[model samples]
Target: MLPWIQLATAKVPGGGELRLMRRGEEFSIRLDANELMNSRLGGSEEALATLACQKLAGRPRPRVLVGGLGMGFTLRAALKVFGTDATIEVAELVPEVIDWGRGEMAGLYGDSLTDPRVSILQRDVGELIRAGAGRYDAILLDVDNGPEGLSRPANDQLYDSRGLSDARAALRGGGVLAVWSSGPDDSFTKRLRRSDFVVNEVPVRAVGKRTGSRHWIWLAVKT
Candidate 1:
């Protein structure tokens, strides 16, 4: 068996640590001791984007904001659905992850970073939402666990009432806010509705097969 190699490491904003490991061609992101994200047979990012786009049909030349760039799967999927003139701003707090994607995982992403349509911001998504008011046509958040913080405590703020409010405020009129989660979040759906968003919960198969692990995506449209 090939030995697992430590590709890179970074300290989380809130005392925890995140580490990336590579075993041959596969990579995984671990928070503390447990695996937080895996780039293997865990699930399908394409399916997630398909569900979100279906919920956001008829929007053209949309300005998109992606909260996280995990493995560049969601970003690639979004680019496929949006037009060439569309802009996608992806905010990732960990700089090392970006560096790793550029150097080690470049083959997986295929120059997505260099794409003119994408603007990579090395900042917190919460701060970005707070500063960007009524700007984006769509905001796709695939940060840490669904409505639960695992890697960073600050992530909890993104799911809270104030954070959801800020996210809604950042979207243009009738814009969609698509949130990816590992599982269903009932209370979070309620909070999204309370924020005045037309909400829909979508369930996607983990591997895009007929039967697999289930993941949830919440599509909330700003009214």
Candidate 2:
């Protein structure tokens, strides 16, 4: 059996450390002691873009904002599902995560990061949402452990009432707000409703073969 090797490390802007690990063919990005994302298990993350794109079918030249690039699963899936006419803006607070995608996990990302329609912003996604107004057809948050902010304390702001309100204002009419999470959050669902989004919570498998821990995805369409 091959042991996991630490590939590299980086600092999260506010506070915290991210470690990139590789074990044979698999890879993982961990924040402190908690594993943030893994190369092999992206089922739920991919679904975040797919489910949201479904709701946006037939929309021309759709513009999408993806928070937290992770391993680029959601970004890649968005390209495939949203077609060539769409443009994607991926906001990743940690620059090294983007580097890992293009460096250590280059094969996993392929050309998604270089695609003409995609722009990788090394900015806090929350800031982008606050500045955007009627600018996106979809806002996908593959963020820090959902609303609980396991990776960084500041991530909690992305799911708070003000954050939800800002996100709501950023979207165009009939836009979708897709969020990826390790599990369900009842309170978050209530907050989504209060933000005036028509929400649907979905359960998905981590391994993609319909086998693994049940991960949740919230597809909330702006109303």
Candidate 3:
């Protein structure tokens, strides 16, 4: 059996450290004891893009915003499903994650980062949402373990009413806001409706099969 090796470490804003670890061919990014993402597990993250892209069919030159860049799963999925005409912007708060995509985890990312239709920003996704109104065809958030913040305290605001409102305002009419979570959150579903988004909760398999841990993807459309 191969032992896990520490590849690199980075500090998260608001006090937390992310450690990148590898065991044979598998890699994982962890915050303290919690594994935030793994190179081998990105089914729900990929679903977060596809589900939202499905709602965007027929929308010309669609523009999408992705809140996280964990191993490029969502970004790669979005690039494939959103078409070549579509433009995708990824706001990754942590810089090291981006480095990982281009460096240690390059195999998992492939050429997704260098795609001409995609842009990578080192800023927080919330700032971009707050600054732009009706700016995107879809806003996909796979940040911080769902609506509940795990790595950073500020991530909690992204799922709050005000944050939800900002996300709504950031989207074009009929645009979708998709969020990926490790589990279900009934309260968050209710809050999405209260924020004026028509919400649907879809369950997904972590390994993209019917036999793994169930994750949730929330598809909330702005009417």
Best by lDDT: 2
lDDT (Cα, tens digit) per residue for candidate 3, span 14-128:
9599999999989999999989888888888888998998887768899999998888889999988998899999999999989988999898788899999999999999999
- Model 1, CA-based lDDT: 0.83
Candidate 1, 1-223: lDDT as tens digits: 9998897888877758888889998888888788776776445456555566666675787888988887888888888887697899999998888887898888878978999999999999889899999998888888888798777778989999999999989999888888888888889999998899899888877675666677888889887
What are the clashing pairs of model 1?
Answer: none
TM-score, cand. 2 vs. native: 0.98
lDDT winner between candidates 1 and 2? 2
TM-score, per-candidate, Cα-based: 0.94, 0.98, 0.98
Rank all candidate structures by their lDDT, best first, as comma-separated numbers. Answer: 2, 3, 1
Question: How far does residue 165 in candidate 2 sit from its true spot (Å)?
Answer: 0.4
What is candidate 2's lDDT per residue for 1-223, written digit by digit as tens?
Answer: 9999999999997778999999999999998998988888898899899999999877999999999999988999999999889999999988888899889999989999999999999999999999999999999999889887887889999999999999999999999999998999999999999999999999999888578788999999987
> What TM-score would candidate 3 get against the native?
0.98
